[model samples]
Target: MNLGYILVVDDEPEIRRLVQEILEDEHYKVAVADGAEPARALYQKQRPDLVLLDIWMPGTDGISLLKEWSSGGRPEVPVIMMSGHGTVETAVEATRLGAYDFIEKPLSMGKLLVTVERALAAERMRRENVRLKRAAEPDTFLIGKSALMQRLREDVERIALSESWVLIVGEPGTGRAGAARYVHYHSARSDRPLVEVSLGAVPPPNVAVKLFGAEQGEAITPGSFEQADDGTLVLNDVVELAAATQLQLLHAFQERRFMRVGGREPVPLDARIIAISDLSLPDAVAEGRFREDLYYRLNVVPLRLPPLRDHREDVPELLNLYVDWLVDNERLAYRRFTTGAVNALRHHPWPGNIRELKNVVQRLLILNRGDEITEAEVEQALGGRPRAVDSAPQTLFNLPLREARDLFEKAYLEHHLGRTGGNVAEVARLSEMERTHLYRKLKNLGINPKAVKEP
Candidate 1:
């Protein structure tokens, strides 16, 4: 359980080991460097949340490192300077150099921990203030009170306590990425970075270097895995990874280490992997499109994000959330949803799930001037699109009785499948049929749930 990443730089081996142990006991991911040289390397590699530096050392002291870091405007991370034989002038100099605080050492463990805690808390507050001043919307949290959503949140909380790789499966617009972030925020590594890698977006030719990193001349360019060391790495659309890249990932997982491109030394793989996909992994494995072993590794804990229609009760809350977001980020005029409007949205088949619902809310707020949105306005915004069950093609009416019935059943089942994002169980419940019977009906109707286009 890593609460945060802390770099402890001290020349004395005993002092370094003691500090590392103490910090580790407090659930921080602690990295130790004997002096400034190794300190620079560790800083470049992991970029720890906070750094504890010893001012006096052979060769380049902590002051030089501080100067180097502060030279390029302000440093991203806060640094605390420590010295054994320190004067008021030295402390003031350290303070002037952008050090958060200076401590005279023969260190008091209690004070050291307290100072670290305060510094970290202050830094977090500063970041929040900056974001608010910039009018940056807060990150979307998992919002819902539906039974399915409650269960999902409980599962996420439980899973966050572990270090196992997670596989999240959902529809295209369902909040899989948001769920991953929620897990990371609650995990032991919450204070560390949550790096996201969209596997499908990365060029196939550059996947290896982008993930494992590349060696350029004498400098080593760190990759996502390295950057997310002791943190969480989210691989979005994991199924889009090429076969060769998947194999490489599998090998890295097996060995728990990987070599950078054109580099001989292996870097330890330390980040927890959270992989997300909008497709069925088992089906992909059966089709030989995804690697079985890799899938199993990532499927240590599997979570299925329910489509918006499956949790219609959450629509009102989602509407409020998105509306608040639009107000903060887009500076839209705030408006309340009338009871009728909320009920209408609750019954809407959000084919695109949360993403679609957000878009609708944004559209309503942007296009309407009223302080309260009514049902009629909602209908107008929806362009009178019929519900999934009400959307059977009129062409079916022209066929003979038996053919028309078959065509209607096919279309109906397909629409339900799309609405549920291919979840057969949800389709069964929505259609008021038993699971096995629904499967048979789908087969008889020649409706492949897998073939349905997820919104």
Candidate 2:
């Protein structure tokens, strides 16, 4: 692999050529600039990892150029100053101007190589530090120890090694975006940036400009695709994209390049695209609400995230994880759930999935004062609407026909009874059944009429 990109800025042709040859031999990609103007242009195009600058030049002397770069909006790269008649004052000035090191000409090849290596290493360390400071929370990775979660991790690992575009499908609040980031974090391009764009969040008028960028006069704004080059671009709620933006994205996917809003030349797309949706793309396509071709393009490698209710065994771990996260990140009081509370949560139907669970955990930790959370607290936290049965739709499929019928009938009766405020006559009218028979069915299903009553 190439070590890093190094730009050699010097007026002397011999010095530029010599330094380029030396760095290239060391497996570093080298870009040579004859003067400050060209160096500025090159830096704007591709920010190099390190710079070797000649302090004395014909125009725009190295000191002046260095002063220009010291201002805001300068590229973040290590610059080493080189001068044949070096002065102590000049060295001090360069040092004050953010130069990494000052080296006298009649350059020692060994010293040059060592200095270059050190500068690059230092730059890498500085960047890594900034990245860590701004990095997403460590809790972004899925939290669970259930078999379903274990298998999901395996699938993510296997798929992350590939280069294909991915489509993540799941229900709302199921952490689909987190799964996409997980794939990106584990992929070969993990070191590169992961840029996310939520299509549904962008206003319709600004959608195109946000996705494809816009150019007005001399100003050019790079969009998500260009910003994520050599990295991963996450399109959240991709199914909610406007029709016009959908067409633009489809073309970009087909061509692997896109022109800015007011530009002629196309910018190459080197980023891996990962699209996410909480809705069914296939159904949207069939219903003519979404473009079929775009759907097919994004559905290259579909990964479905199981809802939290489907993996209830993981609730305790998730509860603890979120509680600890809240305590540490939000500075909430440390709290632990009682065993009964954990059991109750494990049996409760989490309609909002992991996202909802996280919110509930944070709310409980912040709103309640007790160090130990009890089952009654969880019930109040859920607004007393948590499903007691904790049954998943797929679980019914595995049951015998008679058992499945009974389960469905029980749930169905409970829903209508609750909707009707436990008025047997109203439920009977809604179910089209005699009130007496409905009473017998309610008793048979073991549903307490009093429990469904409104206050």
Off by over 4 Å in 1: 1-142, 324-331, 338-340, 387-455
Q: Kindly list the per-residue Cα lDDT of model 2 for residues 1-455, writing each as its tens digit.
A: 79888999999999899899998999999999999878866754655778999999987888887776665343256889999988999999888889999999998878999999999888667756655654545543367898888888888888899988999987555777778877887899887767899887787898888887766643456678866767899998786787888898889989988878996567777799999875446666766879999999988898988878789999988887787777787889998899988988887655456766776777788788867988888778766646523332323555434345555676677677677788788888988999877776675445667777442
Clashes of 1: 0
Overall lDDT per candidate, in order of appearance:
0.78, 0.77
How many Å off is the CA of 175 in candidate 2?
1.7
Give the range where candidate 2 is weakest over 10 consecutive residues by summed lDDT: 388-397
Model 2 stretches astray by more than 4 angstroms = 9-11, 35-119, 126-141, 214-220, 328-331, 387-455
Choose the strongest candidate by lDDT.
Answer: 1
Q: What are the candidates' C-alpha RMSDs?
A: 10.2, 10.0
Model 1: lDDT to the true structure: 0.78
Question: Residue-wise lDDT of candidate 1 within 6-124, one digit each (tens)?
Answer: 99999999989999999999999999999987987787655688999999999998887887767545555789999999889888888888899998889999999999999898887
User: Mind sharing the TM-score for model 2?
Assistant: 0.71
